[model samples]
Target: MPITRRQFLAVAALTVSVREPRAYAADQEQAVFWRAAMPGRNANVLFGYARIDASLVPDIVSDGKRLIDETQRIIAAFPNVEMTAWDLPRRTLPPIWKSISRPVADELRAALAGLPDGVPIEELSGIEVSWLLMGEGQTPPNPYLGDVLARHSRSRGRPVAFLITEKEIREQFWLPRDPIVLNDTIDEPKIAFLLDVRRRVGPIGAHLEQLYRARRGEEIYRFTAEIANQGIPDPSTFIEEEKAGALAFDRLLGLLDSTDAPTAFVVLPIGILTGETGILPRLRARGCTVTPIV
Candidate 1:
């Protein structure tokens, strides 16, 4: 059953300042990953999605000798390390200073315009107003899956490794800056820019949480291709997903080739491992037998 937002925050130790996104089903061992423990199978991996947590599935952190997560985003959102969390707000003031951009101002205007007047939006900035429309300062129910698993692994004395660095991840998520508009005067991702300053991106985000909780991997790929198909909806679409999965898979391959200890879990985005160009197919192509572990 979908837990309430308060329960979700307590269980996941995370927050998203948005309307309640449905939690994953109550399967204790619910997780997504292909195990290639066939002949010459040197590694054990658990491919994971970023947002859903143990509140939704208790055994999220698969038994791993050592963990290899995809990026530092997982570590950043870790329960022990959330204070350094990113995603700050915008600048500027009223009808005079004009600190925020036109897009922000326009979206804020339209969003407030949708509500009854005398609403007292003077104190709210663009992102704050957007959050007000979306919900509040609490995050959606889906917390960082990779971090949850990582934290669990650490607690169990299991070692952890990162497939990429924070710089690399920042680079991967980096977006070209708009010359005119200055959101914190940095190059904000289109997805982030539109989201942080967007009018109505909450519904699509909520729907995504629904799809993810259902564990319909291939359906997720197709769903993006058909419905909320955009860079904003899912920054890692077909090509990017393939490239990322393949790159991570290759790194795992090399790591396994070098190490004797088996991989405890190989955390990655579900979208990166489901479609034709995803990790599982590539693993199969390499002659390794793939089996669904969790």
Candidate 2:
């Protein structure tokens, strides 16, 4: 019998153990160790807008695939996902005003008038949201500020899990011919940033390898999600730019005006469980299959 995508996701969920490992002597000793950087220049940044809900997940295939499909949809919709890097400083910005400052209170008081029903606007006062919007298409040397762009990683308890392609490389793009000069400007590293995604269904067999193969030369793909305003873009724009950030944002933009889609992977999440088993049984009943991302 063949497996479906839902089944694969189920297996991924069962096999996946996202618990973070305890700090070892080496990890503790190396306080200054830098995290591994992702491959490629601009096509490595992952921009995900996921809403976390503590409520229990539902079992229907529609619901299970909804999570997977939506996440993937956001990843797909995101244009130039790779080149979209953020240069947030390691240290967070300091609070702008003291708690007792009247000016701050005054601003909050004025802004509180337009409150949503059942929500207290007063709760937001004095709370430094810290989140802010920095524009897109900014040139480098002025590395992106406000947001910290990082590779996607998932957690099981505390330990974070990263996706590794069974094939040597997951995806590929062209690089500059003059390798030495290119290497001089950017600090190139060996390892790449790992994004973590969990499985919602149960385990399966060799299908993961086949999905990996199918992904090797894929030019066009799709992702679906329930959340409407995921803040993602179309793929056509990304293909047109040939990846602006891949070269240099400034130079790349100069060559191409459209800052539409960011070229990158279309990450999605799916599930299929019922009863206490969560989404697992539903996946099996439907004969769905999943791919292993170990």
Candidate 3:
């Protein structure tokens, strides 16, 4: 069942009113708490999106193991939740951002056949959502899936949201930027999955939003994409593959340096790259919170 915002608030009040710090482990079993509220946000619904962009930034990309460990810690900290944790591979076709360029709507419908039916269309109200994790030289096609998802989301009364950490990747929206590429087409399974999430979360979010609004006496609608298990290899040695990873990382950092929304989540597999440099420290230094998927 969905965790209402009011119930969440009551829990929050209790945590705040407490004074002693709690232990993390219990009975030598890594100390799992029984749905205790985290100090901050109580994310009732956590959708872990699968990421295909496994490349790492040289000297910038952090260790994959560390990323996983930290993320585990984060999840452990959250208490009381309606969590959908699933994992799938990044799309092998055109990249997610460029999925719309090809006549792939039908392709998408087919691709998502095996996914769990967690959300319904009526709940979405016809909103389309988009997802992607790449930027720059590896640009996807225009009128990308983001546009498609937005159109679907707005029209459907459903909110479509993407999970990414790179501010530079999304800069074109808020900044005066040039077209990423005049002509380019890549696999865009991420976009397809985004569309899928829209469909899944549409009904759930719509219902939750309605309930949240009534309980809070205001609008509080936020949709989530529950991601599942993903695997990334070594992420520290990403610079070793500098030719491929560095370019994307450089552009991403550049985008971050120039933008204001510093905090974002990049939902990639933990087994994709190899390296010592992790992406977390860089994000933290920039005041960005890093969330990883196992």
Candidate 4:
């Protein structure tokens, strides 16, 4: 199936969160959103958000709005949003599906057999596939920071920009993975666990929702690392995607060098900000300070 508007934005979301940057300490309460600057005129703020469409997210959205109001410059994730890009793990669907082992495919198809909007395995794309495979309980019918904030900034005809282009992102996923390793990472056990997570909120989702709602960035990061360790496998295809920070950091520097004011960046799944090699820490090395806002 062709990717939908929502699916397209979701593709960009892959760059906005997950995929790479590896380090962190659990004890410190790291701020996901911040006013950060290197040794220059840039004091751009980065707001790392969770993808959950819930009521609590709006509070963070309001804070994000304040940052936008202050800077008047918002660097969004979507083609000039707004080429659309992939979400984590299940990225580049057709090929991933093509590689699926027979038994696992049968199980996944059978599991989706009873869902209300469930379609034949061949029909799924973007979030639908990922949600069915991994998400828990239900999604609240509310807008997330990505939905409400990204659209609002663009609609107002404000100074909107993107740190990473859609093509650069899509190309990142094009890098090949060893199918042998791939099958090992996403085996039947992994599928079953993900299916379990799909039905019940499970401990990670439950705690993650709390941390995300509470705006606990560092905790979220630590928890995310924990989740990754606890058997939630990240696909090998995303290894190349981890290098996104190098380009993103360079572009952000260009924005900082060329501009006279602060810029704002939005990241989904706030925890993606943690990893040792994460861009924020790199900024710190260059005399940039990232101060927590919420």
Residue-by-residue lDDT tens digits, candidate 2, 1-37: 1212232222222121111222211111111001111
Residue-level lDDT tens digits of model 3 in 14-109: 011111112312111110011211223221112111111213111112222233222221211112222221121322122332335455555554
Worst 10 residues of 2 by lDDT: 189-198
On lDDT, the stronger of 2 and 4 is 4
lDDT of 1 at 207: 44
The numbered model that scores best in lDDT is 4
Tens digit per residue, CA lDDT, model 1, 101-178: 566556546545644575555654332332243332223445455556656556566555566544544545333332
TM-score of each: 0.52, 0.18, 0.19, 0.66
Go through the candidates in order and give the C-alpha RMSD of each one to the true structure: 10.5, 23.4, 20.4, 6.3
Return the TM-score for candidate 4, rounded to 2 decimals.
0.66
Where does model 2 exceed 4 Å of error?
Answer: 1-51, 54-62, 65-94, 98-128, 132-294
lDDT of 4 by residue, 1-294 (tens): 343335333322221233232544433644667777666566777777656664656677777666667766677533332332233343344433555568666666766565566434575542344434433323443675567877767766667667676777666633544433443454445555555554455533444566667767655555445335545433323435556656667766666555555455544244345556556666676777777775
Lowest summed lDDT window (length 10), candidate 1 = 11-20
lDDT of 4: 0.53
TM-score order of candidates, best first?
Answer: 4, 1, 3, 2
